[model samples]
Target chain A: MPLLEIRNVTRRFGDFVAVDNISLSIESGEFFTLLGPSGCGKTTILRMIAGFDLPDAGQILLDGQDLAGTPPEKRPVRTVFQSYALFPHMTVAQNVAFPLKMARCSADETRQRLGEALEQVHLTDKAPAYPHELSGGQKQRVALARGLVNRPSILLLDEPLGALDAKLREEMQIELINLQRDVGVTFIFVTHAQVEALALSHRIAVMREGRVEQVDEPARLYAFPKSRFVADFIGHINLLDAQVLEATHGHLRLTIAGLGEMIAPPLAGAAPGGKGTFAIRPEQVRIGIHGEVTELKNHFPGEVTHFLYRGDVTVYKVRLANGMMIEALLPNSAPGGAELFKVGDPVRVGWRHDAGVFLHE
Target chain B: MSDEHANLSPAARLTKWLVSGPPFVFLLLFFVAPSIIMVVASFRYPGEFGGLAPVAAADPATLQGLTLETYRFFFSDFIYTEIFIKSFFVALATTVICLVMAYPLALLIARSPKKSRDLMVLLVILPFASNFLIRVYAWMILLGPQAALSQLVNGVLGAVGAGPVHLLFSPFAVLIAMVYVHLPFMVLPLYTNLEKHDPSLLDAAQDLGANAWRRFWHVTFPLSLPGIFSGSTLVFIPVLGMFAIPDILGGTGDMLIGNLIKEQFLGTRDWPFGSTLSIMLTLAVLLCVWLAARVGSTRGRYA
Candidate 1:
C-alpha cells in the first residue's frame, strides 16, 4: 500500500479552481516532486497533502487512514516553506526543537534530537543564533532541520531552494538528496524549475493550469512526453507539424510540413493518415559533415542560420528549404565542431529512427 | 574632479542650516526654557502674597527659605500618597486594557481590504476631532443615576429592581472615561507597526507546521511588539497626567495624582509642592520609556 494517497482531490477558491481533481499515490521513501509554473496549484496540492488545506472534494489517506478535518498540528506531516519560516524570535536550536516541544516530548530527548538534526544540516555551531543572523542557505538548512526533527511520515518542501543563488542552489540540491536518503522518509517537493525537479525527484508530476499534465520518471518524461505542452515545457524540443503518411507493424513514415519525408518508430495505437506533431530534442539531432544519404532514415538537409557556443555543446539553428527551422545540438568535443558551423552554411541534420517521438496534438 | 567643492556653495550651506535651526531654537525657547524655570521654581520660596520671592524676603506666614517642607508634606500626607498610587494603578490598567483591545484591531486594520481599512481608519480618527471635555460631559448624561446604561447594568447584576441606578462619581466612571479618551493613541501606533509587517512572514509560518496559536505566539506577537510598546507608552504616559476626566467623572469619590497636583498649584497656592510633584511625574514617564526601550531592544535582538 502507498504511504500517502490523494484521491481526486480538488481545491477551489471562490470562483477560481486552484487544484482540479488531482489524484496521486506516493510510495514510502520516494522523492516526489510537483513541478509547474506559478499559479498552477502545485503548492495548493502540497498544502492539502500537509493538512494545511482541505480538499473541496475527495479524500486524503495517510497510512491507510482518511485525513478529514485534521489540522496541520494533528497530521504526521511537515513542510519546509519557500521562505524557510524559521521563527524569527527563536534561536536556531529553539526553532529546531519546536515540534518536539509541541509534542510534549521530554526535555532531554528534545535537546538530543535537536542536536542531531542541527548536526545533520551542519548548523550545530550556530544553534544559538537567530534566523536573521544566518545567511539564506543557512536559514534553509535550519528550516530543513526543524521539519525533519519531528520525524514526520512525509516531508513537504515548497520551493526550498528558490531563494538561493546558482552555486548555493546546486550545493543544497546534493545536500537535500543526501538528507532524504539518510532520513528515509517520503518527500513531496514543489518547484517550477525543470532542472531542479529533474535532478532531485524519483518521480515527477508535471502540472499546468491546475491539472496534472504528466507523471513519470525524469528520463521517460524527457524522452517521450505524451502532449505538446509537456514536451515544450520540459526542455528545448523542436516541434514540427507532420502528417502520418503510413503506419504498419510498429514502423511509421511521417511527411513533415516544409521538411521532406522522415521515417521513425510508430506511435503506439496511432492510425495512418492521422495528423500528429513530432517532437525531437535538440541534442538528439546531430550535425555532421558527411553522414546521412537517402537510404538513411529520419534525415533532413538544411542550412545553418546561427550557432550558439555553450560551454559543453554548440547549438546550431538549421533552416530547411521550405522555411521550417530546427535546432541541432552538437557536443563541443565533436571533430571540427567549433569552426564548422557558422551563418549561411549548408548542414545535414539527422537523427536515429528512435529519437523523435510522435506526440498527440 | 571638484564636484564636491562645487556642490558645497555658500547658499546651499546657508539653506541647510536655515531649514534645521528654527525647530531647535523653537524648542529651546518654548520647551526647554520653561522646563528649566519650573525646576528653578521648585526650590524658590513662596511669598506671602503668592508670587515667588527671593529667599531673603523672609516671609513669616509661608516657609522662609528653600525647604523640603513642601515635598515632605506631599509624601507624608496619607491621602496624597494613596492618590498617587491610585493614579499609577489606573494608568497601568489602562495600558493593559489598550494593549488587549488594540492588538486584534491593529491586525485587522493591517489585513483588511484597502477601502474598508481606509473607512475604518477614518472612524478611528474621527473621535479625536471633538472636544474631550464635551465628550466627558456627554458621558455624564449617559452614566447618570437615572440613565438607561446604569439601570441596565444594575438590573443585570440584580442590585436594583427596575428603577434608577447610580454609577456616577465613582472610580468605574473614571476608568471608563480614561479608556474612551485615550483609545486613538493606542490604535494609531499599533496599526502603524502592524502595517509595516511583511505578510509573507505569516504565510511562511503557516506553511511550516505551526498551528494558528503557535503562529501568533511565535510570529505575529513578537513582530508586533514595537506597536505594543509604542501604544502602551502613548496611552499610559498621557493618562497618568490627565486631570479632566477624573475631575469631571470622579468628583471627590476618586482623586488621582493629577487632581492633587492641580490642587497644590492652583487651589492651595503651593507652587513648590506642585513643581516637585511635576518633576516626579516626569521621572516616572522617563522610567516607563526606559522600560519600553529595554523590551524593544531585547525583542529586536532575538527577532
Candidate 2:
C-alpha cells in the first residue's frame, strides 16, 4: 500500500471548483511533484494533504488511517510555504525548534533535533540570527530545516524555492534531493516550473483546470504523453493537426495537412479516419543538408525559415512544401555550428519511428 | 515652478519660506508665543492680587525679579505630589484597560472581510461625532445611583443581603468614563497595524505545528507590538491630562493633577504656579513618549 492515498477528493469554493475529483497514491520515500500553472489546484491539493484544508468529498488516508478531520497541527505532515514564512521575530534555532517545542518534547531532545536539522540544511552556524538578518537563500534553508525537524511522515512543499535566483535554485534542488534521500521521507512537492519538476520528481502529476491531466514518471510522461494538453505542457513539442488514414491492430497511418503521410506506433483509443494531433519533441528531429537523410524512417525536404543559436544547442524552424512548420534542435558541437543552416537554406528533416506520439484530442 | 523651488539658491529658499509662511507664522503666534510666555511667567513672582506682575520696559532689575519659588512650592507640597502620582496611576490604569478591550476588537476588524472591516472602523470612529463633554455626561446618567445599571447591580447585591451601592461620584465612575472615551484612540492604531499584517504568517505558524493559541503567542502578538505601543501612548498621554472626565464623574476627594492646575490658574489665580505645573506635565508626557519609543525600537529590531 502507498504511504498516502487521496481517494477522489473534491473541494469547492462556492460555485467554483478549486480542486476537482482528484485521486492519487504516493509510495513511501517517493519524491512526488504536482506540476501545473498557477490556479490549477496544485497548491490546493498540497494543502489538503497537509491537513490545512479539508476536502468537501471523499477521503485522505495516511498509513491506512482516515484523516478526515485532523487539524494541521495534529497531523503527521509538515509544509514548507512559498514565502518561506520564517517568524520574523524568532531566531533560526528557535524557528526550527518550534514544532518540537509545541509537541512538548524534552529540552535536550529538542536541542539535539534542531541542531541536526540545521546541519542537514548546512545552516547550523547561523542559528542565532533572526529571519530578517538572513538572505533569501538562507531563509529558505531555515524554513526547510523547520519543516524537517518534526520528522513528519510526509513533507509538503509549495514552491519553496520559487523565491531564489536561478543559480541558487539549481543548487538547492540538488541539496533537497540529497536531503530527501538521507531522510527517506515521502516528499510531495508543488511547482509551476516544468524544468524543476522534470529534474527532481520521481513521479509527476501534471494538472490543468482543477484536474490532473497525467501522472507518470518524467521520462515516460515527456516521451509519451496521453493527451494534447499533457504533451504540450510537459516540454517543448510541435503539434501538427492530422487525420488518421488507417488504424490496424497496433499501428496508425496519419496524413497531416500540407505535410506528407506518416505511420505512428500503436496508440490506444485512436479510431480510423478520425482527427488527431501528431506530437514530436524538437530534439527528436534531425536536420541535414538536402538528399543526406536516406537512413531515417520518415524524411521531408524543407527550408530553414529561422534559426536560433542557444550556446549549447541551436533550434531551427523548417518549413516543408505543404507549409507545415517543424522545429529541430541540434547540439552546438563546434564553434558557430549553427552557421551551417542560414535562413532559406534547403535542408531535409527526418525522425525515426517511435520518436513521435499520436494524441486524439 | 516645482523645478524652480527645487533649487538651493537663497532666492529659492526665500520663495519657499514665503510660500509656506502663513502656517509657520500662525504656529509661532498661537503655540510658540504662549509657550514662551508660560516659561517666562513660571519664573516670575505672583502679583499681590492675582496673575504675574508686569515687568517694566528697559529695566535691567526686571531680570533679577524672576525667582524659582513656584517650582520650589510645587516640590515642597505633598498634596501636589500626591495629585501627580494619582494622575499617573489613573492614566496607567486607563491605558491597560483600553489595550485589553481594544486588542480583540481590532483583531476582529483586521481579519474581517473588506467591506465589513470598513464598516467596523467607521463604527469605532462614530462615537467621536458627538461632543466629548456631552458623552461623559451621558455616562454620568448611566452610572448614577438611581440609574438602571446601578439599580440592577443593587438588586443583585440586595439578594445577598447588601444595601444599595454608590456607583457614581467614585473612582470607578471616572475609570469607566475614561476608558469609554479613550477606547477609539487605542483601537484605530491597532487596527491599522494589524490590517497590514500578512495572513500567511499565521498559516505558516499553523503549518509548523502551532495551534491557535500558540500561533497567536508565537506569531501574531509579537508582530502586533508596534500597534500596542502606539495605542498605549495614544490613550495614556491624553488620559493623563484629561480634566473634564474626573471633574464631571469624580467626587470632591478625587482631584487629579489637571484639576490641581485648573485650581491654581483659575480658582486661586496663581499664574506662576500654574505655569510651573503645565511645564511639569508637558515634560512628563515627553518622558513617557521617549521611553515608549526606546522600548519599541529595541523590540522592533528583531522584527
Candidate 3:
C-alpha cells in the first residue's frame, strides 16, 4: 500500500478553486515532485498533505488512517518551507532540536539525534551559530535538519531551494537527494523549475491550472507527453497540428497542416480522420541535407531561418516547404557542427518513425 | 543647478554646510542653551525670595554659595525619597498593564486583513485626537462614586453588606488613566514589528510538531522582543515623570516625582532645587533607557 494517499482532494478559497479534485498516491520512500507554475495549486496540495490545509471535498489517508481534521503538529509529516523559516532567536542546534524536544524525547536522545541530524546535513560546525549568522545555503541545511529531526514518515519540501543562486541551488538539490536517500524517508518535493524537478525526482507530476496534467518518470514524461500543456511545460517541444489520415495494423499516417503527410507508429486511442497534436522534442529532430541520406521515413525539406549557439548544442529554426516552422537541436560535437547550419540555407530535418508522440488537444 | 552640485570642490561643500546650518543653530539656541542654564542653576544657591542667586565671582563669601546644598537636601529628605520610590512603582505598574493589554491587541491587528488592520490602527491612534487632559477628566467622571460604573460596582458590593466604593481619588484611578493614555505607545511599536514578521515561520514551527502554545512561545514571542523593549521604554519613561494624571485623579498623599518637582518649582518658587530634581528625574530616565538597551542588546545577540 502507498504510504500517503490523497483521494480527490479539492480546496477552494472563496470563489477560486486552488486544488481541483486532485488525487495522488505516493509510495513509501519515493521522491515524488509536483511541478507547476505559480498559482497552479501544487503548494496547496502539499499543504493539504502536511495537514496545514484541510481538503474541502475529499480525504487524505496517511498509513491507511484518515487525516481529515488532524492538525499539522499531530500529523506524522513535516515540511521544509520555501523561506527556510528557521527560528531567528534560536541557535542552529536549538532550531534542529526543536521538533525532537516537542516530541518529548529524553535530553540525551534529543542531543544525540540533533548532533546526528546536523552531521547528516554537514552543519555540525554551525550548530552554535544563529540563523541570521548563517548563509542561505547553511540556513536551508538547518531547515532540512529540523525537518528530518523527528524522523517523519514523509517530508514535504515547498520550493526549498528557490531562494538560492543557480550554482548553490544545483548543489543543494543533489545534497537533498542524498539526504533523502540516507534518511530513507518519502519526499514530496514541489518546484516550478522543470530542470530541477526532472533532475531530482524519481517521478514528476506535471500540474496545470489546479489539475495534474501528467504523472510519470522523468524520462517518459519528457519523451511522451499526453497533452499539449504537458509537452510545452516540461521541456522544449514543437507541437504541430496534425490529423490522422490513415490507421493500419502497425503504422499510422498523419497529415500535418503546412507540412507533408507522414507515417509513424500507431498511437493508442487515435482514429483516422481525428485531429490531434504531434509532439516532438527539438533534440529528436535530426537536421540534414536532402541528398545526405534517404533511408528515413519522416523527412521534411526546409530552410534554416535562424540559428542559436548554445555552447553544447546549436538550435536551428527550420521552415518546411509547406511553411511550417520547427526547431531542431543539433549537438555541437564535430568541428563543423555549428557552422553547418546558417540562415537561408536549405536543410532537411528528419526524425525516426517513433520519435514523436500524438498528444490530445 | 545639477551641474553645480556635481562638482565636489571645497566651495560646494561649504555651500552644503551653510545650507544645513540653521537647524544646528536653532538647537543650540533653544535646547542646548536652556539645558546649560538649567545645569548651572542647579549648582547655584536659591535666592532670598526665589530663583537662583546672582552669580558672584569677586567676593569669597558670595562665591561660597555655589555649593551642593540642594542635592544634599534632596538626599537627606525622606518624603522626596518615598515619592520617588512610589513614582517608580506606579510607572512600573502602568508599563506592565499597558504591555499586557497591548500585546494581544497588536497581534490581532497584525494578523487581521489589510483593510481591517488599517481600521484597527486608526482606532489605536484615534484617542489622540482629543485633548489628553480632557480624556483623563473623562476617566475621572467614569470612576466617580456617583457614576454608573461605580454605582454598578457598589450595587454588586452592597449585596455582600459592603458600602459604596470610592475609585476616583485613588492610585487605581491614576493607573487606569495612565494605561488608557499610554496604551497606543505600546501597541504601535508592537504592531509594526508583528506586522512585518514573516508569517511562514509560524507555519514552519507548526510543521515541525510545535503546537499552538509552543509555536507562540518559541517563535512569536521571542521574535517580538525588540518591539517589547521599544514599547516598554516608550511607556515607562513618560509614565515615570507624568504629573497631570496624578494631579487630577490622585489624592493629597498620592504625589509622584512630577508633582514633587512641580511643588519645588511653582509652589516654593525655588528654581535651583527644581532644576536639581529635574536633573535627577532626567538621570533616572536615562538610566532606564540604558538598562533597557543593555537588556535588549544582550537578548538580541543570539537573535
Candidate 4:
C-alpha cells in the first residue's frame, strides 16, 4: 500500500467545483509531482493531502488511517507554500525551532534540531537574520529547513521554486531533489512548470481542468501520453489529424491529410479505420532537401515557409501542399543552413515508425 | 511635470503662499492662537471676580512670573492623583482588551471565505456607524441598577434573594464602555495589516513544520505589530481623556482626569487649574503616542 492514498477526493467552493472526484496514491519516499496550469486543482489536491483543505466527498488516508476531520496542525504532512512563508519577525533559528517547540521538545532537543535543520539548508551563519534580510533563494532554503526540521512523513510543496529566478530555480530544483533524498521523506510537489516537474519527480501526475489527465513516470508520460491534452501540455507536439487505414498484428497504418500513409506502431485499445490524432515531437521530425523517403515510415513533402535560427537549432515552418504547417528543429551545424532553409524552399519532413502516436483529439 | 514649471519664478512661490494663506491664517487664529492662550492662562491665577485674570497685566505679552501652583494643587490632592492614575490604568486595560479582541476578529475577517468575508467585515464595522454617545448611553441602560443585566444576575443569584445587583456606576462600567467604543478602532488597522499579509507566507510556515500556534506567534503576530501599535495608540490616547462614557455609565462619584479637568474649568470656576490639567493630559497623550511609536518600531523591525 502507498504511504498516502487519496480515495475519490472531491472539493467544491459553493457552486464551483475546484477539484472533481479524483484519487491517487503516493508511494513512500518518492518525489511525486502534481503538474498543471493555474486553476487546475493541483494546489487544491496538495492542500487536501496536507489537511489544509477537506474534500467534500471521499477520503484521504495516511499510513492506512483515514484523515477525516484532522486539522492541519494535527496531520503528519507539512506543506511548503509558494511564498516561502518564513516568520518575518523570528530569526531563522527561532523559525526552525518552532515546530519542535510545538511538539513539546526539550530545550536541548529544540537547539539540536534547529542547528541540524539550519545546517541542512547551509543557512546556519544567517540563523539570526530575518526573512527580509535573506534573498529569494535563501528564503526558500530557510523554508525548506523549517519544513524538514519537523521530519514530517510527507512534505507538500506548493510551487516551492516559482518565486526564484530561472537560474536560481534550476539550482534549487537540484538542491530540493538532493534534500528529499537526504531526508528520505515522501515529497508531493505542485508546479505548472513541466521541465521542473519532469526533472524532479519520480512520478508525475499531469492534471488538467480539475482532473488527473495522466499520471506516470516522467519518461513514459512524455513518450506515450494517453490524451491530446497531456501530450500538448508536457511539451511542444505537432498534432496531425489522421485516419487509421489498417490495423494488423500490433501495427497501425494511418493516412494523414498533409502527410500521406504512415505505418506506425500499434496504439493500445485503438481500433482500425478509426479517426484519431497523431502527435509528433518537433525535434523528432528530420528536415532535409532530399524528398526521397529514408528507412523511416512517415514522410511528407513540403515547402519551408519561415525559418527560425535559434542558437542551438534552426527551426523551420514547413507548409505542405494541403496547407498544413509542420515544425522541424534541425541542428545549426550546416554552414549555410540559416539561409539554406529560406522561405519557399522545397523540403522533405520524415520521422520513424514509432515517432507518431495515436491520441484523443 | 517639472519641466512645465521650469519657467516658474520666486514670485509664484509668493503667489502660492498668498492663495493658501487665508486658510492657514484662519487655522492659526482659531486653533493655534487659542492653544497658546490656554498655555499662557494655565500659569495665571483666578481674579477676585472670577475667570482668568492676568498675573502681570503690566507686561501683557509675557508670563515670566507664572507659578506652578495649579500643578502643585492637582499633585497635592489624592482625589486628582487617584483619578489620574485610574484613567491611565483604565486606558491601558482598554488597549490590552482591544488588542486581544481585535487580533482574532481581524484575522477572521482577513481569512474568512470570500463570499461572506465582505459582509462579515461590514457587520464588524456596523457598530462603528452608530453614534458613540448613544452606544455608551445604551450600555448605561443595560448595566444600571434594576436594568436587564442586573435582573439577569439577580435571577442567577436566586438562592441569596438578591433582587437587583449593583452593576453600573463602577469602574467595570467605565472599562466596558471604553472597550466597546474603541474595538473597531483597534480592529480596522489589524484587519488592514492582516489583509495585506501574503497568505503564501503562511503556507510557507506550515511547510516548514511550524504548527498553528507557532505560525501565529512567529509569523502572524509579528507581521501585525504595526497594526497593533497604531490601533492601541488610537484607542488608548483618546480613552485617557474620555469623559462622556464614564460620566453616563460610571456615575458622578467615579470621575476620570477629563472629568476633573471639566470640574476645574466650569464647576469650580478655576481656568488656570483646568488649563494646567489640560496641558498635563496633552503631555500624557503625547508621551503615550511616542512610547507606542518607539515600541512599535522596535517590535516591527525585529518581528
Higher-ranked by DockQ: 2 or 3: 3
Residue-level lDDT of model 1, residues A1-361, one tens digit each, is 9999989988999999999999999999999999999999999998888776899998999988999977777788888888876777789998888888777789889989998999999998999998889999999999899889989999999999999999999999999999999999899999999999999999999999899999999999999899998899898999999888888886778888777788777787777778889899998887765744333576778899988999788889998778888998888887776787679888778888877789865
Per-residue lDDT over B1-303 for candidate 1, one digit per residue giving the tens place of the 0 to 100 score: 489767888998788789989998999999999899878878776655565666665666744667777677767878776776789999999888878887788889988987798889889989878987899999899899688898788888676456544688888888888988888889999898888777756655554556788778877888888788889888999999999888999968688888877877778777877888888788878987998798789777864
Best by TM-score: 3
Off by over 4 Å in 1: A291-296, B1-19, B55-80, B153-166, B195-211
For candidate 2, what's the RMSD?
3.2
The alpha-carbon deviation from the true structure for residue B17 of candidate 3, after best TM-score superposition, in angstroms, is: 5.0
True-vs-predicted CA distance for residue A56, candidate 4, Å: 4.4
Task: Output the lDDT of residue A305, model 3.
Answer: 96
Docking class of 4: acceptable
lDDT per residue for candidate 3 within B166-267, as digits (tens), equals 889889899999999999999999999999889999998888888999989988898899999999999998999999999999998889999988988889
- DockQ top scorer: 3
Tell me the TM-score of model 3. 0.94
- Worst 10-residue lDDT window for candidate 4 chain B reads B202-211
Q: Which residue pairs in candidate 1 collide?
A: none
Regions more than 4 Å wrong, model 4: A8-21, A56-58, A248-251, A266-272, A291-297, A334-337, B1-32, B55-64, B74-79, B96-176, B194-223, B245-252
Tens digits of lDDT, candidate 4, B214-267: 778767887888888889888998899988877888866779888888877778
Tell me the spans in candidate 2 whose CA falls farther than 4 Å from its real position. Answer: A245-252, A268-274, A334-336, B1-33, B55-64
TM-score of chain B of 4: 0.85
